[model samples]
Target: MNDWTSGYVAEIGYTYDFFHAMTPTRMGLAALSKGVQHPFGRETFSYCELGCGQGFTANVIAAANPHIDVHAMDFNPAHIAEARALAEQGGVQNVHFYERSFADFAGSPGLPSEFDVIALHGILSWVSRDNQRLVYDFIAKHLKPGGVVYASFNTQPGWAAAMPMRRILTDHAERGTGPLEKRIDDAIAFAETLRKSGADFFANNPDQVTRLTKMRAMPRNYLAHEFFNKDWTPFHFADVAADMGQAKLDYLGAANLLDQMDELCMSKAQLEILDNECDQVRRESLRDVMLNEQFRADLFVKGGVPFTERGAVGAWFATPFALARRYSTGPVKMTWRGLEVDMAGLDYDPVLQKLSEGPATVRDLLAQGLFGAMQWADITRMMKYLVGAGFIVPCLPLDGIAERSEGCRQFNLAVCKQSEETQKLSFLASPVTGGGVAVDRMEQLFLLARSEGHETPESWALFAWQILAPQGQRLEQDGKVLETAEENIAVLQVRAQSFAARRVRILEQLGISLQPIATAQEASVASSAAA
Candidate 1:
């Protein structure tokens, strides 16, 4: 193997927490689909991350969708081991981690074509050409009908700037004979000399120059791992489209949906000129306008599936208001549900209004509102209330609306509760703790019950009792211990009905089909038995 591939492999082995920070993206997608109607049943939804590394993204998805099974795999045995360990530590039971190469997966016999969504982040650019072909084939054979696959890779125009740097680093490595660290040091010295010579393209661009300078200042391992990757390839939009077509997948949308520059936004004359051009040319022209390089996240739908474009659901143009003038005072008058009200009087209205304009941090909202008295502590409570009310959402600021709409608070809470329950169940089933449920396990059970459907504190308490009843435990309420089977059945039935209603609403919102989990008669019998 080349030093570049060796270094890349070494880096993957050394950095165990690879892609953990990117977990929010997969989690956000799950949360966003909560109220949407999918053609597949909710429980049938599944996600697979190609080049999953240490399975950070897989763990996050499993945590978000306890009812849905997750599968994570990597060619590196060491990486898979680390991923499995992390999943076990996190008490995540929903994910099945495996050490298998793309080639092996492609050649495997009788593997079910089960995945609903396949994510390939930073994989296509780093893998060899044969591996890339295997990846495409795997997606083609494994992804279910109408499934969406997210593939992010390095793209052209941006790579125009990166290619020269790669060449410079490769030449420097060839001139040096030592450990990877010494070679990286020599490479950095060479880059600095070129920078001083002022004869390079990077030197002409201030941003690229700054980036190179900062990168050189980083650790030797970082430098060696990044610039010395052997199989790194940057492709154009047209080429990617053709590749996907070969794999029996059709481009549906961009994973970074907002970044897919709209032709409508261009001037009328420009739009008319581009209208005659091909899709590839239009896409390239748009990317040029955005100055995007390094990464392009495209979504592909399975071929032979009827996927009608939803025509931008819930898209709104934000009317920019002068924050300095409009929100400079304390308790400004705001319109809410048609009536004007003091923004401070109602706990969540002000926060909701700010979010409506666009997403803002609690600090940003406070600063914009010119609130001199209330601190973040006071504002946090109101923000939580707004999140509970489904007015405002919380998200990691990666891509604008993609993260916001998808990272729904209620859905996150549900997934979190389910994760906790799964973890507790795993522990209870383990040989340790004398095969008895731990206190923490019981607490998580109650939390899961509440999040699954129960609304009131009393309902949560009742659900908890029902869960504990199977283990010969009862709840003490109002100085009395109630352990009746009928009471347990009543609580279970009510909670199930409530959850079913919520699930229906979520399906309607997401435009997904809702399939009944059980018939009415079966549900009644199950509820009666539990009671």
Candidate 2:
């Protein structure tokens, strides 16, 4: 039988995952941070995602930003089916899903044209070169000038130390003869045996040992896609930039905010060594070498228009931001080379304290006494650092985003209802971020229960347990699978106690948690008294 998958893994699907980097709103901020004005045209805009696995990111983005028309495509029929079901569940009419390869989509008459934003979560590193060209062709013909592209892939130097081991694991996987899952397991176990037997390669590369150990603990399904794919390759930053330049695109910056910080990008000594390199691509390539960066998330623009310092600062300062979650009441700390890097003495306290109260534009943060004397450049750097540290997140200003919930509610409800059958419903749409966040199985269940009038966490937990019990499922805690009814309930009660500690607040911040309504009598009395 001739295989049409073209070296792609078709037997098992990609993870039902949502990556935050795929959102256009986030891309806009990322571009602004780099001194470019992202083309978020007012009143109307369009976005597309190539290889949108299970369509989680696409659907959620559509549901959240109802004004933006969104489109998503994946070659897997199963993935497309799930994406469509999800869009239907979310009542997300603004988005369209197509089950077609890049080639087919490129050829199809129904394909979208002039998209303002085109993104790929992990396509360049996974697909054949032919498919990659097809992707470039799609972008070349369809992307509008000033359009932004978000693409992520495995990169060189980071994957260099482990290439030999990856080859061994994949070679074993290709030689095995059972289901894809079994083959992946055999490959991992084989790698473990080599490590235990004092393999010379393991001895020479201590980092590879760390890599294999982490691999052993990773989910087999994720490993199947990561190692077993037939067309796995890593690129240097220069190579990717050159390849993308074919489509008249320019590199903006990394999707992960942390990469923006040169201090974090390399050791102090390394930065000093490469400080004189003026070429942007070469600078990034050198940084990649220092960190052994295995994976990268980057943004590109179809026709990038330069912004003057004044214009860039105006655009950047006008953007509002909010605390992604309530911060811990202490200094944010990071560890590097066995030493802790604390921001307490750096004067970030008052800024975070103000953001915690509500969303604040850069102007709002700077106008305060603590930051008033600081330059816009200095203040922006601190905010980006906070975003990189996960202490804060970029949010859509409340004024810009219209209030709408029908699509998000429907989509989240579909997700909750699906959790009744499978626990892979791991994310929910976030209106505030115009993206999705990781909402674990337990929290998903609780949210669903609450929507149905399960008053408290205990009631919600019990309600979720009743659904699981019918399917011969039980909760697990501390690696212990609770088989008995009493044990499961006990575990859920404990989980319930802590769920409110953080998850409730997070849900409220994301605008997903339903609010209590006033009683009719109260409303009537207030109306009558006013009259």
Candidate 3:
């Protein structure tokens, strides 16, 4: 195993890039919305990313939520220098980058328990056991009450295959000559030699054989990071939970929603059989079915904070509410659980209609007549409904622009090659329907529409009207353009309503449940009529 100091110094850039690419903003928001407390306030929060390489994730969060002060730290000075440079280049001001190791910071005086969210992605498994203890101690001492910590690590079952591979590579590299690449080739050759040794683990399982073959083909850097490390210890889930408890933290949840590995994915019979088993062993058995015993993102919260009922905060935010507009786009489709809902059919049609465009701040949305005459509480409810149903993703930044859009694509790619996870989130926040539409071209369309003097809420809407006018005329049998503002507004209203309805349906199919919009009196009257 490699020493901690050398591992920290060697290829610090790669380590920084790996953690920086894991966006903690979305994870932080989800955890907060799910009842996690933040340091600043319930809605606002402070955060820090341990081992924050090049400060990429910190920069994005700082750009997204200027209100949230994000601190990024790494033991490696080179990594810190690169992160600071990246932050400056991006003009991100809210993040404070520090070049200090975890042990130094933990032992140093004057550190505050100021961070509401602490993220240690891919750090624990790589560090020495003593360093891991230091990390846990820091979390216990510094994390604010109700705060959440995001820690990811390698685990068993997955490591069962990975451990031997690592040993083989490390031994081979020690004996081989030439560069890292050539040594890696020699290491792979050793893995093949092991497979031919007639071992039951490799011979009996074709799936394992195929997996080993793929692992052998990975780059030397990957092999070094995975197998050559001196302190590479894979953990069991229950043991992890117990270890967290020992550190004055409680297991909150997992970062990957898909990897919950709960009763939902297990048959009732299987769950019943495991009911009597110990928590650690039970998780091991479940991982056997899930086939994901290797990598995990575990969320933990400080203990002693009173546990409130789940969904309490959600219910409070679900009342009708108003927020600013954040971005511009065309009609959007939202689905929930494979069912479509008509947003127009709901009482909040007018509001949802206004938000169908690309991302928009809550304040902007309200200012644009979407919540016309609606109570402030009602507007809050509507916004919460949209957020809960995933119609409008919560962007923490007051400006509503995605911090990690194509605008930053070049910078991100320059610093770190595109990964599947980063690509997917970027697509979700993109302005254009597919990949990305050029910003200048989109602006040109808006300008052209504005020059036409169409009385629409947004320039994009006017552009759509201009393109659709000829078709509308042909359908109406009148060569005359729809000249009346009221006529255009009425037509746009219907179109907007229809668009909202379709989007609502789609959102429902995607598992987002929106509340029916209605006042107390109106709901009573409708119910009476139905009865």
Q: Which candidate leads the pack in lDDT?
A: 2
* Tens-digit lDDT string for candidate 1 (17-59): 3232123232233222222222232425676777787665565
Clashing pairs in 1: 35-506, 35-510, 36-510, 37-510, 37-511, 37-512, 38-512, 485-531, 489-531
- Writing each residue's lDDT as its tens digit, candidate 2 over 1-531 gives 126677878788778877877766667778888877677635578888898877888887888788888888888788899888877766788988888888788665565668888989878998988888899988888999988889999999888888899999989988999888888888889998988999899999998888888987887767867777789889888998998899999889988766777675466789886788888889889888877788989999887887898898777767777677667577787664345655443678787788766667777776777575666667777777777676777766675443544456667778877887898878777667667767888778877776665556677679878988999997778887889988998788677656656556656556564323223223223323322
lDDT of each: 0.51, 0.77, 0.52
Ranking of candidates on TM-score, top first: 2, 3, 1
lDDT of 3 by residue, 357-464 (tens): 334445565567766787654554445445434444443332322333323332323222222112211211121110111122222222233223422324334554
Indicate whether candidate 1 or candidate 2 has the larger TM-score.
2
C-alpha TM-scores of all predictions: 0.55, 0.91, 0.59
Q: Positional deviation of 377 in candidate 1, in angstroms?
A: 36
Clashes of 1: 9
CA RMSD of all predictions: 16.6, 4.3, 14.1
